[model samples]
Target: MTTLQNEPAACAHAELAQLRIRVIALENLVISLLADTSERQLAIARDMATYISPRPGFTPHRPTVHAAAQIIHLVGRARHFRPMAPSRRSR
Candidate 1:
């Protein structure tokens, strides 16, 4: 394949790795949130909405809500356990 053709694959691999890291982070956040998933989701939704549809006042410049949802979904599907949350906790 030509260099031009190979460029897409390299870019995809880099993108995938970046996405994986993001997914892992999201999963950990979710697990920490635990049964409070709704609160966690609402927070993410608010942040994302502010980013995508900035208000008349000061607003965030983050990605859209859809993007956040996608990341959450990927995390749920890809990993069984969160990386940061200690597997064994002390009393």
Candidate 2:
């Protein structure tokens, strides 16, 4: 009886672990895609972060604002992975 009771919990734990792995993989894929984008596109994405920013004041919804901030943070992190352009003086 104890084993049967624990089975569902174990299965749920396994499923949660798999979901975490998938989320990490998706995040890595997005970072790679962002890294490959042109500078112009990256700049546009940075601009989008600003657009998503919540205006200062009391608000009923907080999760939406937090998610937007997270997105902005992710964009900033992905930008760090972008390759630096070679200087023209190197030619």
Candidate 3:
């Protein structure tokens, strides 16, 4: 009876120890994967700076067909047709 009791405890201890080792190994693997990802991000950022142009004027709108449509909409919204003057009030 004593041997049987000790057998179960030993089995539980061994199983717990194995689980701990596996958890530690998995933690190390995740850390290594994160480090690799960081290195990759740095490489991609360098590539972007090397390839992308940086000489456009400081305009809020992108130089696209969408910007043209937006400009037309703005002009249509203005009540007066003056380029740099406001309309006089008819009191």
Task: Please list the Cα RMSD from the true structure of every candidate, rounded to 1 decimal place.
Answer: 9.1, 3.0, 23.7
Instruction: Tell me the deviation in Å of residue 83 in model 2.
Output: 1.5
Cα shift from native, residue 81, model 2 (Å)? 1.8
Better of 1 and 3 by TM-score: 3
Model 1 lDDT, full chain set? 0.60
Clash pairs detected, candidate 2: none
Which ranges of candidate 3 are over 4 A from the true structure? Answer: 38-91
Instruction: Return the top candidate by lDDT.
Output: 2
Cand. 3 Cα-lDDT:
0.51
* TM-score for each model: 0.37, 0.70, 0.40
lDDT of 1 at 88: 60
User: Which is the leading candidate under TM-score?
Assistant: 2
lDDT of 2 at 10: 97
Q: In candidate 3, what are the lDDT values of residues 1-91, reduced to their tens digit?
A: 6998899899999999999999778655544443444445545534543344333573433454454443333333331332332454554
Clashes of each: 0, 0, 0
- Residue-level lDDT tens digits of model 2 in 1-91: 6999999999999999999999889878878888888878877877776666666774535776676676667677787887777863355
